[model samples]
Target: MLDIKLIRENSEIVRDSLRKRGDDEKIQMLEELVGKDQQWRQSLDKANALKAERNKIAKQIAEVKKVGGDASEQIKRSAEIPKEIARLDDETIALKTRVDEILMRLPNILHESVPVGADDSANVEVKKWGKPKEFNFELKSHGELAESLGLADFDRATKVAGAGFNYLKGDLALLDLALMNYAINCMVNKGYTLIEPPFMMRRSAYEGVTDLADFENVMYKIEDEDLYLIATSEHPMAAMFMDEIIDEDKLPLKYVGFSTCFRREIGAHGVDTKGLFRMHQFNKVEQFIFCQPEDSWKYHEELQANTEAMFQALGLPYHVVNVCTGDIGNLAAKKYDIEVWFPRQGKYGEVTSCSNCTDYQARRLNIRTGKHGGDKKSVPHTLNNTAIATSRAMVAILENYQNADGTVTVPEVLRQYMGGKEKLGKV
Candidate 1:
């Protein structure tokens, strides 16, 4: 949600942002909100004037009665004023409700640093890490290699749970657990408090962390219940401090949330139907931060650097891209995606995304910070990044570490976590 005061004072800025975002419909809605607000203000003023008149009349009637004069006419007039005031009050409340409905539909204001673009193709690559290796032999895709080694069982998974699901068997299952433990430990070393939050959240709380449209497409709401399964740990972590005020000293709060995330994948077809690229459920270690407004940009960079370090430690080649305007979404003012290289596909696929939401979510969640009665309250900024999505990490590992003899070499950093196992899928 955007600040209505900002829209009232700087409507041109909001209009131009919507234009740049390719959302003319919201621009029209802004006009409606302004009109309704004006009417509400006028009605409120009328109601206040009537209230003042009623008070004065009551005083006049009391004085007349004290002097032994008839006060019946004054009493009748005063009663009529209250009925009029009540009617106008109802009108004002309706107008305010309409205005609020439109406000929720408005997107966040774009930051000045964001690039103007329509889609991901317009996104600019800011940096590149390690190079993609040259293979002397034909490289097998992650799915092919995992199935041949009896490490992944998609057929049984489909029979058990339908499409877009898989079962990791043998050493691959162990590798998945190793990746989760490794990522959590890495985050712990970086001073983030580790939390395993609830896998489900109430609809009211969920709305605070995501766009309203997501309720229909992305989320899995339980039938006849107010609860919805979380799509990421970020959702629950971000809502942890909803409708609360924190002390200024606790400005920069950080957490590494681990959970089993679920997505509906409603329309996904003919894409990664055989592998783990797009799954209905997966494990993730996510990074979330809440900090003062002045320090959010600094924390955004630090968050990006932290994810890059994790990838480098795992020996995965990746690059960073500055997300374009349309593709960045409304939650984040600016975003950076770390696309890790997949040797079999000959392309870099997105493995992690870091976003600086800059108070956009804070406003919706009503999260603020200030001293008690000494300083003015202000909304804090929010940021989140994927420390590691275990499935995608496994995808990169299976293809990049594949040997000519079909054995998979474990990344040196994760070997200790996997009980000193150096390789997987060996007979």
Candidate 2:
């Protein structure tokens, strides 16, 4: 959520941001909120004046009584003041609620560095890493290769859980774990505290981290409960300090989170529905940080570098793109996506995303930083990056590391974690 003060004072800046995002409806909503806020301020002023008048009348009544004179008139006026104050108070509360509702839905202000564009096609490529390798033989899809090597059971997974699910068998399962361990260690060695956050979260907390109204279709709600299965560990990790104030001395809180994420994938059309590229449930390692606002953009790049390093270690060819305005979504002011080359697809697919949500989430969650006793305080900035989504990483590996003889060579970095195994072949 944007700071109410920012909306009230620098509205044109906010309006321009909305225009850049191509959201006219939100612009109308912003005008509505401004009107409502004005009304709320007027109502609050009336209530406070009535309260002052009542207090003055009480003093007059006491003075009259002390002098042994009539005080009924003042008492009557004071009694009437309470009723007026109460009405105005109720009006102000209602207006404030309406204002907040719209404010919560408003998208974050884009950073000046973010590219102004309508969609992903306009995203600018920052740089490329290793080049795609040449294959001498016709390549099979990752799904076909996995099944052919007896490494996965997609047929059985479909029979039990429908499409968008899979069962990794034998060496494939171990490779998944190895990926997790490798990513986790990569982050841990970089001074990030390891965390295993809850897989389910309350709707109220979830709202602080995402636009729940727009994101509901992508989330799985727990039946008859206030909880929803988390779409990413970043959600819970970012919400960890909701409604709390941290000391300025502890400015940057970096965390490496691990979780099994679940998503409804509603309306995700024309994507890989039968393979590891997209899934209803998957294991992931996430990087999250909470820091002072001034240092957020720096941490944002740091996160991207960390993720790219992991991919580099695994010998995966990839490139980074600066996400355009429209595709950047509501939370991030700016974002970067790391796309890895897939030999079978003859193109790159996104394997990781990094975002810098500068005070947008902190304002919603009421996360602040202040001195122990000083009055100065401000909202902290929040950021998150995909260290690795094991499923997608596996897809990249399966396609890039497939041998001509229907086997997959394990990445050198993950060999130790896979019990020194060099290849994933038929069991």
TM-score of each: 0.93, 0.95
Report the lDDT tens digits of candidate 1 across residue range 1-427.
8888988888899889888888878989999998998898999898888889999999999999999999999998887787788898999899999998888878888878777889988878999999887889988888888899999998899999998788899899999899899989999999999999999999889989998888888899899999999999999999999998878887799999999889987345442325878888999999999999999999999999999999999999999998888888878888999999988777888899999988889888988889856568999999999999999999899999999988889999999988899998642
The TM-score measured for candidate 2 stands at: 0.95
lDDT of 2 by residue, 131-170 (tens): 8989999888888888888888988998999887888999
Global lDDT for candidate 2? 0.91
In model 2, which runs have C-alpha deviations exceeding 4 angstroms? 58-72, 266-273
Candidate 1 TM-score versus the reference: 0.93
lDDT of each: 0.89, 0.91
Off by over 4 Å in 1: 51-75, 266-273, 373-375
C-alpha RMSD of candidate 2? 2.0
